[model samples]
Target: MPAADQNATPPGFGITLDTAAAEPRVVVTGELDLLTSPQLQEALAGLIADENSRRVVADLTGVTFFDSSALNVVLHAQRQAGERDVELAVVPSPAVSRVIELTGVAEHLSVADDPRP
Candidate 1:
């Protein structure tokens, strides 16, 4: 029997912060699962905690995979943003849209088709 390749690399994951725009944006890319969700949660928490932050845009358009753990992070962030009187908008990619639609979280979250007006 052949064994799996030990040198195989895992899917790439990244998070970037962009505050140049009027609204602070967190741009996420690559796969998002239980292992990577915490990074996302932390990023969102930081933005929501900031007193100067009035609005935040989570640009998940580059994400290739979004699992239930990722969904939970987003939902938690949304709730925190609300409590802080901050607006949270999510720009989902096609891959993410399917999960949001199937989970019916679109109504609870501020889902935007585009990042800009």
Candidate 2:
């Protein structure tokens, strides 16, 4: 079996996890659609499972594309976060913002400003 890189990046996509801060942040890049949504969901799920992860910020500023599937994954993560007593926030790209606006999912998520430093 191949060993997994702690910084494993999916094909055509990348995820950066920063857990040192008060709130863990997951920065995603590349296209987010049906094919890549599962990878994102899995990453979010791991964050939710962590006991120290009381709050999570998903920074999608680097996302070039997004779709309904991507929206659903974020929504699901939000719901799971609630169940785990974790607060979830998202820094969406313009493309993601458009879908959230169209689907009325924005109200359900805490949208944060991009926190890249």
Candidate 3:
């Protein structure tokens, strides 16, 4: 693994996939809505597909805004991680956590203080 780098910015969103650590970290910034959910989905899917992947941490601390579509993407990633036997944790910003708590998905996914390894 190398150092962390800016991976992509898809329209209204930006994703930084840090693969240098033991468990890859995907940090999402900007608005996570209908237009940006797929970017996150693809990034997470790519991380999960790696056989070397043991776990993946989604750091949503940079997210300024979040919506149900983004939450849906996280939930889907959680399920995929489970099937792959890969641990998945989420570090949510206040805005993101509020939505997660409201939707009761927080209990289903591991919420961590640190998203880094």
Model 3 Cα lDDT, one tens digit per residue, 14-110: 7889998878989998889877788889999999989999989999998989999999999999999999999888999989989988888777898
Candidate order (TM-score): 1, 3, 2
For each of the candidates, give the backbone clash count: 0, 0, 0
Worst 10 residues of 3 by lDDT: 4-13
Compared with the true structure, model 3 gives a TM-score of 0.87
Predicted structure 1, TM vs. truth: 0.88
Off by over 4 Å in 3: 1-12
| Cα-based lDDT for every prediction | 0.90, 0.85, 0.87
Off by over 4 Å in 1: 1-10
Ranking of all predicted structures according to lDDT, beginning with the best and ending with the worst: 1, 3, 2
Kindly report which residue stretches of model 2 are placed more than 4 angstroms away from their true locations once superposed: 1-12
Return the lDDT, model 1, position 3.
Answer: 89
Summarize candidate 2's per-residue lDDT along 8-96 as a digit string, tens digits. Answer: 54566887788887778888899988777887898899988899887888989889899889999999999999999998889988888
Residue range 1-117, candidate 1, lDDT tens digits: 998675443568788988778888899999888877888898999988999999999999999999999999999999999999999999999989999999998999999888864
User: Given candidate 3, what's the lDDT at residue 114?
Assistant: 77
Of 2 and 3, the candidate ahead on lDDT is 3
| Predictions: Cα RMSD each | 3.9, 4.9, 7.6
Flag clash pairs in model 3.
none
Of the pair 1 and 3, which is ahead by TM-score?
A: 1
Indicate whether candidate 1 or candidate 2 has the larger lDDT.
1
The candidate with the higher TM-score, 1 or 2, is: 1
